[model samples]
Target: MTKDLYARHRSVLPDWLALYYEDPLEITHGEGRHVWDSAGNKYLDFFGGILTTMTAHALPEVTKAVSEQAGRIIHSSTLYLNRPMVELAERIAHVSGIPDARVFFTTSGTEANDTALLLATAHRRSNTILAMRNSYHGRSFSSVGITGNRGWSPTSLSPLQTLYVHGGVRTRGPYAHLDDRDFIDACVADLLDLLGHTRPPAALIAEPVQGVGGFTSPPDGLYAAFREVLHERGILWIADEVQTGWGRTGDHFWGWQAHGRSGPPDIVTFAKGIGNGMSVGGVIARAEIMNCLDANSISTFGGTQVTMAAGLANLNHLLEHDLQGNARRVGGLLIERLRAVAAQVPHVREVRGRGLMIGVELTRPGTDEAAPEVASAVLEEARAGGLLVGKGGGHSTSVLRIAPPMSLTVAEAEEGAAILERALRSI
Candidate 1:
């Protein structure tokens, strides 16, 4: 049955749409932290559908909200007043930290980011944009234009004139050998040099933690320093928080808070977990930027009642239970455990990340060469051992990405870590 389905999927889906493992598993059902694939195999879900499942599988509050909203009204175009949408927007605006914030909903992170780009360009009257090297915004044409990772970015014909910046990855680059303070200074100097060569950009867009770039990040306050420069030139700072938002980073509610010395970003884009599996994405910006468009614009399905209901419920659950705190505690222990395990593995290059968004980079034993094959082997072995994880890196997917739900338990973390240890050993 699985083989037949696989054949059908390959025939129907685009070849570029990648799947996991030697044999991809079709997950049929889930509960809490576990999911069942076809043929009745159960695995502990670590990746959470690319970290979209924030709280848990089949969370009762979100389920109830969705079901109730669907029964009442699933969708209505932006022509009418949407109570759920308004409520969710109000909550988001309050938490966004931007003064006089305005929220615009979309269907995915790509759309949210595209909207942000539109606002920034229109408001600042420039198509030039600055993005960090190894950063990924989304997959849409506009979003892809700003992406700096070569593997994910397919073309150079972009609507925006994009300049790739430094300091997204601190492990391997021209300044990797420098200490944290020196590295920050070098990146700042490089930014100043880059700014001299180009027209003033509309915005400098970045992810607080580069998600698809193997969860890599610069030292704390790097962005704050960059913000100072950008602010001086009246350039907008946009934080792409698709994977790092909603307390997944543990210590902060938003990933941008790590660089809080510069205050809030001019714009913030978020998706992936806000609706707890419902398709909800949005951008938050101050009124001056958000209201820059002369003509009206709307997303037909953006703020549908059902998705808004789910978003509201999910946000309530996250805050009520303090899932962010849970992420910090459990994720802290999980990373420590994995670090211990990685120390014994020959190919493990580095272990890094905050809260549940951890990464284990693989390299050739005793060498700096990226070992993508070793990462793949570890992924397959971990699946066989009843664990599911993810892989991503600028160096051909050479890093193991471990992002469990924010509601992860300590025991579950221990279990996942043990399975990962065995998988690393097998590799």
Candidate 2:
């Protein structure tokens, strides 16, 4: 049955849409932290649908919210007063840390980012944008233009002039060997030099933790240092919190908080996990920037009742359960366990991340060269052992990304670690 479905998927779907595994398993249903494939095999889900399932699989609160909202009214355009939308927006604004903030809802992160770009360019009156070297924002035309990763970016033609900046990845760049303070100084100096060459950009946009760039991040306060320079030039700072928001990073409610010394970013964009799988993406900014557009705007499907209800319920559940604390406690133990296991593995290069967002980089045993083949073998072995994980990196996709739901238990973490250890040994 799985084979037949796979054949049909290949026939109908775009070839560029990649599928995992040599024989793609059809996941039919899920509960708690586990999912079952069509063949009746159950696997502990670590990737959490790319970290979209922020709480858990089939969470009752989210399920009930969606069901009740659908029964009442699923969608009414932004043309009307959406009570649930307004409520969610109010909550987001309160927690966003942006004063006098306003929220704009969209159906996906790509749209949210697109909206942010529109505001920044319109406010600054410049089409130039500064983005990090190893960043992956989204797949839209505007977002791809600012993306610096060649593997993910498919086109060069863009309305905006994008300048790639340094310091997103601290391990493999020109300034990799520098200590934390020196690295920050070097990156800021590079930014100053780059600013000298180009016209004033509207904003410098970056992911606090580069997600598709294999969970890489710069030293703490690196962005704060950059913020000083951009502030002097009146350039806005945009934090792409798609994967790092909603307390996923443990210590910070938002990834930008890691560099909070400089102050909050001028604009913040988020999606993934806020709705626990419902498509809820949005941007929060001071009223000045958010209301900068001259013409009226409305998202037809954005802020619909159904998605807003789900988002509100999910957010309530996350806060009520103190999932952030859970992530910190459980994720810390998981990383330590994985590090111990990796110590015995020849090709595991680094285990890095905060909270539940962890990455295990695979490299040649003694060299810095990426070992994508080894990563693939490990993934296959992991799947065979009933543990599901993800693969990503700028260097030939050689990093294993493990981001379970915030509700992950210590026992589940240990179980996943054991299976992963066996998979690494097999590789």
Candidate 3:
């Protein structure tokens, strides 16, 4: 059935679409932190739809709003304003700590990012966009041009001006001992120098904790310092919180907030968790930048009625249930457990990330060459054990990307970690 479905869609879908990563499992439905395949096989979704669906799947409130809105109206296009869209925009701006920040919605994370790039380029009226090496923005031409990873940059990459720099925080000594203030300072210094010298960039796009690019968490002072430099140079600081937004980091409402920013980004883009599996994304910018988008800006399917309802409900549930608090508590427990497991397993290179957005990088038996094959083996083994994980990073390193729903339970976290430990032992 899966093969037939793929075959039927192959003709219309672009040949470049990488559908092979998905196995033959026909996912029927999902709830909370688990999903079931067509054959009634249950799999714990540690991947959380690649870090989206933070609150969980088929959430009661979100589903109710989606279904109700679907009956009333599914879409009216950007030409007309809908209540759900309006309310969602208001709520997003409110939580973002940027009052009256205008929003431009899109149908997906890639679309949101693509729109952000266009807005930044046009607003700044400059050519250069600075991005971190090994970062995964989106596949759209403008975004792919700025994405530093070569893996995603094929012939389709846009011929636009851009600069790339090393991203992610580096750690030394022992996994048992974190809080390496000195190392953090050095990383900050190097980054500041790079950005300072490469001034005049239209915008510096970054992820709070480098997602796909190994889930690297930069030094504590990196983002704020970088923002200061950008402000001094009049460069826009674009925070691509597509993967890290919506309280997944636990301590804050958005990953940028986790960076200790008093105010949010000059422009902030989000997608995944806003709709909790439905297609929706948005860019929230300061009024200063928004005023610049007076005309000649639009998105065809931005924040459709149904999607906006879903996003609004998801955000509401997140706030009411204090999912951010859960994320912090559960995420801390999960991180500690992962570090414990890594200590036992020599193959585990580093366990890095914040909140529930975690990645476990694996090295060779004794080398720096990212053992992607080993990572693949671990992933396959975990799947066979009924746990679904995700992959990321430059060489697609052995980073078991475990971004389960923020509703993930302590018991689920332990079970998932155990399964992962078993998979690592086998690998």
Candidate 4:
């Protein structure tokens, strides 16, 4: 049945849409951190649907909210004063840390980033943008313009002139060998040099942890240094926290907090994890920047009652249960466990990331070259051993992405890590 479904999927879907594993899976149902395939096989889900399922599968709170909202009224758009929408907006604004923050909701992260771009471009009256090398924003035309990752970006044509900057990747760039202070200084100098050559830009968009680019991040104070330079020139700093937000990084409530040395970012774009599995993405910005556009705008499917309810429930659950602390504890153990095993594996070049959002990059045994084939083998092997992990990289390298729900138990983490260890060994 899965084979037949795969055949139909290929016939109808675009060729570029990728599926994982040698044989694709049809997931029938999931609960907690585990899922079942069409063949009734069980698997411990480590990827959490590409980091979207922030809480857990079949979370009762979120499920009850969705069901109750659906039973009441779910179709009310932004035209009406939706209670759930406003409440969720208030909650997000309080947590967003942007001064006088205002929230705008969308259906996906791409649209959220698109809105951020529009705001920055309009507020600054310039189309030139600065983005970190190997950064991934989203798939929309405007978002792809700012994305520096070649693998995720499909087109060069863009509405904005996006200049790729340095310091997103910490281990493989020209300044990789430098210590933390020197690395930050080098990247700041590079950014200054870039600014001197180009016209005034609207914004510098970056991911605190490069999600699709192998979970690479700069030194702690790198963005803070960049912030000072950008602030002097009136350029907005957009923190794309799509994959790193909602306590996934463990130590901080938001990934931008790690770089909060200067101040909170001018604008923050978020998606994926906020609603757990529900489609909820939004942008938060100060009043001046958010109100730049005079024309009335609304997202048709954005901020619907159902999605907002789901978001509210998910956020409440996350905060009430202190899942961030859980991620910090469990993720710490998991990463250390992974590092211990990775030390023995010749193919592992690096094990990096914060909290639950972690990456294990595989290279050739004795060479620095990326071993994508080996990564693929590991993925299949992991699936065979009843574990599900994801893969990502900016430049065709294979980085095993391990981001389970924030509520992952210590026992589950141990089990998943053991399964992953076996997979890496097999490869």
Give lDDT tens digits, candidate 3, residues 260-360: 55356888999988788889988888877776756665567887899898889988888899888898899999999989988988788888777898989
Could you give candidate 2's per-residue lDDT for residues 49-86 as a string of tens digits? 99999999999999999999999999889999999999
- Give the TM-score of each candidate: 0.99, 0.99, 0.92, 0.99
**Cα lDDT tens digits for candidate 1, 138-186:** 9998889999998898888899999999999999999999999999999
List, residue by residue over 1-427, the lDDT tens digit for candidate 4: 9989999999999999999977899999899999999899999999999999899999999999999999999977788889999999999999988889999999999999999999999999999999999988999999998889898989999989999999998888899999999999999999999999999999999999999998889889899999999999999999999998888899999999999989999999999999888999999999999999989988889999999999999999999999999999999999999999999999999899899999999999887789999999999999999999999897775899999989999999999999999999987
Residue 189 accuracy (lDDT) in model 1: 99
Which 10-residue span in candidate 1 carries the lowest summed lDDT? 148-157
Cα lDDT for residue 426, candidate 3: 92
Q: Which residue pairs clash within candidate 1?
A: none
| Candidate 3 ranges beyond 4 A from true positions | 3-15, 20-23, 156-159, 171-199
lDDT-wise, the better of 1 and 3 is 1
lDDT of model 3 at position 170 = 52
Provide the overall lDDT of each model, using Cα atoms, as 2-decimal numbers: 0.95, 0.94, 0.79, 0.93
Runs in model 2 deviating more than 4 A are none
